[model samples]
Target: MARNREKEDVESRFNPPVSISMADSSISLLKLISILIIFVVGVVIGLVSSSHIDRYFTFQGDEFNFKNTYFDTEQFSHDGQKMVVNCDGEDCLSMESFVRLRNLNHRLRDDELFWRASFVPQKEELPFRRVPRVAFMFLTRGPLPMLPLWERFFSGQDVEKYSIYVHALPGFDLEVSNSSVFYRRQIPIAACRMGSVSLVDAEKRLLANALLDFSNERFVLLSESCIPVHDFPTVYKYLIESIHSFVDSYDDPTRYGRGRYSRRMKPDIKLADWRKGSQWFEMHRALAVKIVADTKYYTLFKKYCKPSCYPDEHYIPTYIRKFHGALNANRSITYVDWSQMGPHPATFTAGNITEGFLESLRNNGTRCSYNSGKTSICYLFARKFDPSALEPLLNITAQVMGF
Candidate 1:
């Protein structure tokens, strides 16, 4: 009897009751479920908070701020309706509609589509008399040392005939009097490095902004070093009356021209289609709009035209030749002296600003076709002028250039 009791106690110590084991198992499973539930709830709360934060920062009072960088939006009451004006100027469209039209992203593909779709064809004649205005687009790094000279060129001219636009480095503001023509003409721009695609981007950005105004019929691209070789009237008449765009485009078999052509450009751009020319060009409104709306060839150049390729020098020339050959005069209206054998053209300084030199630029003995006939009045603007030449240029403007 004693041995039987001892064996039974040993067995009881080795194994516990099944009810107690089941109860512990149930408690452990409950704890695990509670932990999982807490985790899921926390994740849901985090996602909701993140969404709200994104919304709060993205919009404010009917204004779409692009990280507070691109455009400055102002809200005001106009005739009992809320209106938002962009940094460019007063826009009568509702803020929602304006945002929809001006919604540009960093993606070039989407932006090109938007611009192409926004283009309105002039199929019908307008009821009101439309006065065509020339858009003078200046691409500069920072301040315009030649602003005084340009101010003189535009002085006393009818405001209805011309519009001024400046594309400077981002965050740069030109300090000028309120009455100055370029007082509020700076457009939103990105940083541009010499000989890079960013330079091409800046050019396109300037064109896009000028296209916003319906009155702009002609677009002229100028640099900070560029000075008007002729007065406003002469230059205006030359550009506005021209039937073809003045773009320097030519076929060269040299290493610098066709040699820069890449095989990757393939079916889109061929070796025979390659061209080289000056970056400074004067284009009509139709060409300007085409350039802004182009994505097919622009993408090709942006991808294949790397360093040494120089997109600014080649892309526009090649594109114009390929697509709009007949519309282009195949010559640049901006004079640049390439006599010096180097990568860059000769830059004119204060001492070089002579009446004879100015005369040479005006009629450089080179005859070209203008309006289906030949004319020697080739260049309307000369570039690569140093800042020191501003004073001399201003002095000779009235007598030689005839402003």
Candidate 2:
């Protein structure tokens, strides 16, 4: 009996109690399930927090996210009337309405920024239905001496078909009759010097202002010295109906052309991409928007194309050729007589404003490629007319120039 009792005690010591083993296994499973539940709950909470943070800012379409860039989401709203952004067919904002909402106190130094901020990338194409008009943008220094001639030209035409925006020097005021076409048409002015980047800025400003009007389909950059050689209807129809824009883009490998290229402009503008042309451009609405919204090429030109380089002459030509070559005819309708000596074109005085001279300007010039065919009557306007020639122009415009 003593031996049997000792054997039973040894067996109890070697084997573990079944109840304690079962309790330990159940406790381990419970611990693992609790850990899993905590992990799942943590993940759910993180997802919900992130979703709420993203919801604080409302993104407009996929293209525009003006939440925190230049404007605040709150600034876009006022007194419960939420600002509605209407994008045109080209995916550009209607600048008229946009400017109204913008904080004028916080204007940026870069005008191009305004245009870039207003750009909205279009996703689905919408049906386009708007009667388009021409925007005759004039870049001038002070008074438009040829206003009388322009008044005669635009006299009988429907005002709805065309719009005029003039950019002049600041603080230079002119007496404009209410009956005149240029009356009350001057836009906000900035000091612009010839052959400077300021000229390009003024040009872009004019374009930006005209873009506010959705009806403007064509943009023609003109000067105070410029006068329409063709009548209002004729010039309007010619510009609006044309399939390609009239921009004089040519490769001048000579001293004045390729020599103007700055090495700093490289990586963005290569030597092969160098171009030169007339500053005056008549572009379709699509190209005009692109010009206003461009920051890349404009910045390059502003830094590189300077005094002798002439940004006004080089910027548009190189930009258009590099990107929108197919949309251009590579010619300018404005006639400039560079045959005379000096940097300036031949300026026509009162003595040179005869009917024959005007007629020659109308149809007697070098042949140019128009609509894929050569034409003799290519010039639609002429430049560098003396202020004194205004009366002579007025005298002969109705009889000879057919204005």
Candidate 3:
């Protein structure tokens, strides 16, 4: 018996029993590894599922009644300049164009683009003539009364040569004929009251919409009251070929100019930089892009240039003068007769319509310097024509305006 006990004790010492704590720890480790693997698998599956869903929607343009809408990065590249849709499904150019324009609002808010508003580098000159178009932006309270005249003006111009964008008052319906140039070209607009920050906002909104078309080389801001004084060819040649933009920026010692400067705009916009001019303007693509991208000067104006300041008159003039003074002609091409005015310019009645009056606005019996020492016709547009004058003007359109 004693010998058996000693042998058993020796066997026990030689081969130690497994520990309970160690066994529990090993099981726990295995369980943790299993859980981790399941989690990883779930995450991978989720990502793949999300990707599949995205692909499904992207190619399902046909499901939404869109045709010839195969996905191509080329169409949407760089502000959608080359965008085309051969739609057998829906009229993509009508509502979809606005969608594309609205999408640009998101890109405009990008931190990189918004902050880098000071300047953009010039693109390399290509051998091919990628002739860019002009965007004619009309800001109106409702329907354009001058639509017939504008239609006559735009009749012969190629469809690719220009684009029209309108910002009418929200909820104001405009009944336009399908043949009208301004038809279905309205952008989503916020409320805009004249002589307020809203007016500046409207201008910016117009510019932003125009900037979406990378092919738009120039932008012209027109009011409902504005009318073309020059023929389409002459107007196109003057605006498209001109090196400098037409933006009147001048020092006015009068109450309407320098006196309108707000003390709150100090440091960034000083009294020296404050200027006043007609709200009508025409700018090259570079300047237009800069205007849309601007936050520094725009923010300052929004904060300080209230009703008394007439922000529309001062904001653009001051901003362009401060940063891009050299690029402008320092005079508005849109003529306004401020001589007979209260807060507005003189409005022409039907009786005021005449060949001699139109000629006078175009020539004014004097020459203005253009492109540095080259004297030429000064004005391109005239404003504040009454709606009643449309017929009388149309009566003489072909004979007087050469349209």
How far does residue 230 in candidate 2 sit from its true spot (Å)?
1.0
**Candidate 2, pairs of clashing residues:** none
- What value does the lDDT take at residue 269 in candidate 3? 87
- Which regions of candidate 1 are displaced past 4 Å? 1-91, 94-118
Alpha-carbon shift of residue 24 in model 2 (angstroms): 48
* Ranking of all candidate structures by their TM-score, best first: 3, 1, 2
Clashing pairs in 3: none
What does the lDDT come to for candidate 1? Answer: 0.82
The runs of at least 3 residues in candidate 3 whose Cα sits more than 4 Å from the true structure, single-residue gaps closed, are 1-129
Estimate the TM-score for candidate 3. 0.73
The C-alpha stretches of model 2 lying farther than 4 A from their native spots are 1-129
Q: Please write out the lDDT profile of model 1 over residues 137-235, one tens digit for every residue.
A: 999998898889899999999897888888888788878999998877876667888878888888888788777666778999998898888888888
lDDT of 3: 0.81
Q: Report lDDT (Cα) of residue 62, candidate 3.
A: 50
- Count backbone clashes in candidate 2: 0
- Local accuracy of candidate 3 as per-residue lDDT tens digits, 1-403: 9999999999888876679658888999999999999999999999999999998987685555443354344455586567554443232445445323424323344344334333444657643345578889999998789988999999979877788988889998667887877777887677988779889888888887777665678899999999998888888888898899999889999887888888888898899999988889999988987887877888898888888888999888999999999999999899898896587789998999998888888789778878867665899899999999999899987887799
